[model samples]
Target: MNVAFTSRTLSLSRPQLFRGIRKVQSSFATCSVLSANRAVVYTSNGDPSQVLSALTFSNLPPPPPNTVNVRFLLSPINPADINVIEGVYPAKPNPNASLSSSGKGSQDEPVFVAGNEGLAEVTNVGDGVTHLQPNDWVIMTRQQAGTWSTGMNVKPQDILKVPRSLNDVEAATITVNPPTAYNMLHDFVQLNEGDWVIQNGANGAVGQVVIQIAAAKGLKTINLIRNRNDIASLTEYLSNLGATHVVTYDELSDKSFRQRVKEWTGGKNIRLGLNCVSGKPTTLMTRLLGQNAHLVSYGAMSKEPLSLPTSLFIFKNLTCHGFWQSRWYDSKSSGEREKLVETLVGLMRAGKLKEPSHEILTIQGSEGDEEASQKIRHAIATLAKGQHGKKILLKMEETF
Candidate 1:
């Protein structure tokens, strides 16, 4: 282990540095992995072949400075993660380390881990790392790659340290869905007490969090979900999270749905419409908003293109924006991230926040575990099956 004594006043001795070095080494149960060499690659885009065995691809060692060796404590597979492996997702590549040698850094390399986000703990810290000690919990500071494996050696700047109080699940889920909901609610619209917000995919990871957050902040929510026979059950469940009204897409398509929302909200201005679904759903949502409201699109799960009237943009003065939580969170310091995590954790501890509903699946594959991948596909196929939960995780491990 290398040591940097920033100031003469510093107190780490030789023995302590030696201990830190030992602590920084990654020890995984899988001995077949030689992390110092090539990483496992997903050579092509397709089915399970797309997430095929981490075949070898040659690469140099970890890039220099401001980097760290990270051991994956856990990587949870969410829907977007499955889309990435299928090679259909817009976002691309997950590299554990990028070639920062030329200053563009290893992060630029195309081949990397496949997860958009996951939780990790530090194993080694290169020069200039002070805030993080070995074994400290962290979430990715950037997006794409390097999160699906057992461990990775990456830059310190790409990993955001979590508050000691945050649980692994919350930490791993930090980078994308949760923060997207957070920023959309707080950043785009200037919401006020008693204001109302409407959103699609209400039972989604982001949507569920929005329900609770909006309620916590004294704002009401009108949630939208796809048609399910148990729609009534789903409604009651979301209402428990503070949603004011829960309606189906068919219900939403009704000419009176907007009137119902306006009536339910006591005609209080609905300032924000969160869209993860495009096409007609988004078009109808745009009309539902109060004048000058913001319509934020974060995903196009419907796979259908967006179509809307120009009159809304011209006359209603609506502002349309796109958001990516990964990009926004990457700009903050480790310190700021820890604090945001602290607030979220505090909510969790106080019963204000709940885990995303999930069905844990053990990964079992011919060469490795395939259960995680299978379960992921299942989750995507039947997303609206459940009334109030999102998949907890799709984890890859050596043994069941």
Candidate 2:
């Protein structure tokens, strides 16, 4: 459904405020006349393929004070995004949004846009916004910002300006996986240069980032993945990413692998373990840790409960903690977030950080609403079936 835009006059006392208002008003007028926006939206929490639809709407009106209008360049479809859509995640979308397929909405019905992380360019800034201007690149710092749309109005505090040097893919994905990996490594334990780290699901996006960051820090990683047919090739691929050793869950199941791990680390204590795949495999990995080691879990890819032996905790002094990047963002200020982004960008510029392998699913403005909806639904269906090994990014055309 299309939204209608209306202009409002602002009462400004300062000269700078008047100038900002005029600039915003002019930009808003142009956008109201020329722009059409579309979003992947759903009314209720359920299977994305059944609930999600392509919603075409008028461009947003002029942003209110302390807000900025932004056009999203790219947004990634993270596994967490799917969980959020299914209503299984902790974060919820803002339901007060005025959106509908028929250009009308009742108080009882609320529309939810789907997406959390994205790269966007500021198109206009409202009065009282001085740090951002037109064409500045930014990434959402707010959880569940509904980034699937072509454009939206956001608070200045909810977004952080990123360096233009970062390519679209890197900027789009920088807000989530990389930060998760970076924080888990630094926040949990203080590892020496030759220390060892162990993790399951090591070929997944965050795992790969962990491997590279660990390697850069001169720490070793014992990477774990599920047994697959192309085991040798996968090992080689992860090894090149600086994984000291790549082991399958089958190998981890064997009792002798613990001794092998000891030999790999030269009998040194494995100080930190990262777990995304919980269950018996995680318990097996935990057994290999030395005294006072920490285990940080960020995800449960296997949807299994993390059950660990009590003996390990009591005898070995093993510490267990849960991590969520969204929580991390909530705990930090905008300046702190900016500093983290700067560190990641430096890593990217220095070749220490590389973009995750991804496929872009483009929704063209030229396509009819049904055609676009079908494309999104098909992609979500494929993801639901575990068909995609790489990340899937959504690139929405502006003129929808």
Model 2: runs farther than 4 Å from truth?
1-35, 100-108
In candidate 2, list every pair of residues with a backbone clash.
Answer: 1-101
Residue range 1-400, candidate 1, lDDT tens digits:
2235475425678787667656544332242233332223454566643344442222334535777777665566666765676777777773333433332124444444566677877877777877787889888766775576555667776777776576667667766666667779988878988888999988778899999888888988888899877788888889998888888899888987877776687776678999998999889987888789898998887879878799988888889898876667657776777676666767777777776766554443223223344454454456433332555553444321
lDDT per residue for candidate 2 within 252-324, as digits (tens), equals 9997998898789889999899999998999999999999999999888889999999999889999999999
lDDT of 2: 0.88
> Could you say which candidate leads in TM-score?
2
Span of 10 residues, lowest total lDDT, candidate 1: 31-40
lDDT of the candidates, in the order given: 0.68, 0.88
Per-candidate TM-scores read 0.75, 0.89
The residue ranges of model 1 lying beyond 4 angstroms of the native Cα positions read 1-40, 48-51, 54-66, 94-111, 125-128, 330-339, 363-389, 397-400
